[model samples]
Target: MPLPRPLAPTGRVAVVAPASAPLDPADAHAGLSVLRERGLRVETADPAGGPAAYLAGTDDARVAALNAALARDDLDALVCVRGGYGVLRILDRVDYAAARAHPKLVVGYSDVTALHLALWKEAGLPGVSGPMVASDWGVGLDAETEADFWRVVGGDAGYDVRGPGGEALTPLAPGEAEGVLLGGNLALVTALLGTPFLPDLTGAILFVEDVGEAPYRIDGMLARLRLAGVLGRLGGLVFGMFTGADVAPGRPTFSVDEVLAHYAPSVGGPVASGLVYGHVPRKSTLPVGVRARLTCGAEARLHVLDPVAA
Candidate 1:
């Protein structure tokens, strides 16, 4: 199946909340302002601001808002407001059929990883594993992250992403792997292992990252992937920024390096070193199911192999 094409900057963008509680109007406005400055027109549906506990709204309500947006011929794409716990609650409730038939650039990370995987599995349309409208852009994505977002959205043919200026990549395995890039939050990817939404990783470079998870927790999650045969199936692996800010006040019992080494061999493929994407500021954007080339040795590099939709 062909990947979903990205919308041009002037196209109308739909802001919705498949997850997260309610959004603060102030934050939403700030984010939309940034998009507007970039030449995009963003509009919100009624449920975009509605609240139902920790979700934007009720399962049915959220689904309705999303479906309504997807059904619109005028909306060029949908951008999630935030990624919280509730998206999984309404995972099955989305009308992916119409949306897939009329592919739109769906964006978000973290909880939104669920949506990304679903869209790829059910619709065969690739979506951005990037920032959400409310948090990423509003909270101030570092200059690098902001640039990476436009690069992916503009469908830059292929490009390389390096670690932040002085930051160094910690190599896990030495070599290179080329194939479609697939994966998001380590926790989310592991959570869906036995589920239907998990993508086929036969020859894909898997990338994962997360926020607030303890190193031990990261270890456990990677272990689950190994047990579920996820690691063993990848063509390669890319470890993203595991934000330590969310870890409790104590020293981590395990380091990310240890966790990567433990599972690197199980993947039966090359494992690229540290990648600066995920729960950190200035995160790099990646299309969940797009193809890419990952080289790891003395230095590390991720070269997108497939063209992002334009």
Candidate 2:
């Protein structure tokens, strides 16, 4: 995996709305301040307030804003303003030649996942899944979340990330394994299953998270991965927060935990839940296409085995 150069404390970064517009101007501004507080030079690529039909802007507009950012020579990285439902539409519009020509970290989660996958396929560079200006940063990040996010993006040395439940992981499937860290939001991951954008997860620690999905839908996506033979080649599975996935009484369905319990064991490698990376307030960041290790036991922790950036 090719890691981009690690962003320095005062590195230049651009914020762009590649998916949905920031719902609130203040939230977006506040989120940008978070990056500034991290000692970064943050700039907005385009007006995040630009409106469209459920998009931050028209497909061309969004693509152009992103391309402009990617083409810049002074930027050290790019962070998204928000993620909703437009990145896939502009995924192919990315200036791959420019992106590959000047590799740097691109950060976001949720619908921005499509962009990350597209970058991997098109630019052959990995991305960081962390706080977005309108979401995680605007809401507020706990110390653990903020530290992990910066450490993954700014530092050169890899570190260990223990789940919330110390001593032992919340749910552990015995064994230890290492592989390239990959995957993000469950919905986006499933959406790209049959697409050229999806990377080959031959032996990757596939971490997944999602929100507002029912238990059955979550199970369905996981089932799709399994049926697609995607899970069979995994070195491990890191189950992150699946918020709003509680089953309602109306439908007869297996619980999210049940679904994971059923599949994690079958992966035949370390499996654990409660990773602090998802659509949660206090969440950590993951570097896609980088080496990671998972040790399942009383002292289980996901260790970033390699630098995500130079």
Residue-wise lDDT of candidate 2 within 1-310, one digit each (tens)?
3457788769999998888888887998888888789789988887344779789888888899999888887888999999988888877778988888888899899998888877887778889988898887877777777767778887445677753323235646888888888889989999998888888888788888999998878888888998999888888888888898776677788788887788886677888987867887776678887788888877567888777788
Residues 52-93, model 1: lDDT tens digits: 777788788888888888777676678888887777777677
Candidate 2's TM-score: 0.92
Error of 1 at 198 (Å): 1.0
Ten contiguous residues minimizing lDDT sum, candidate 2? 162-171
**TM-score, model 1 to reference:** 0.92
lDDT of 1: 0.77
Candidate 2: C-alpha lDDT = 0.82
Q: lDDT for each of the candidates?
A: 0.77, 0.82
State how far residue 119 of model 1 sits from its true place (Å).
0.6
Runs of candidate 2 exceeding 4 Å displacement: 47-49, 163-168, 297-299
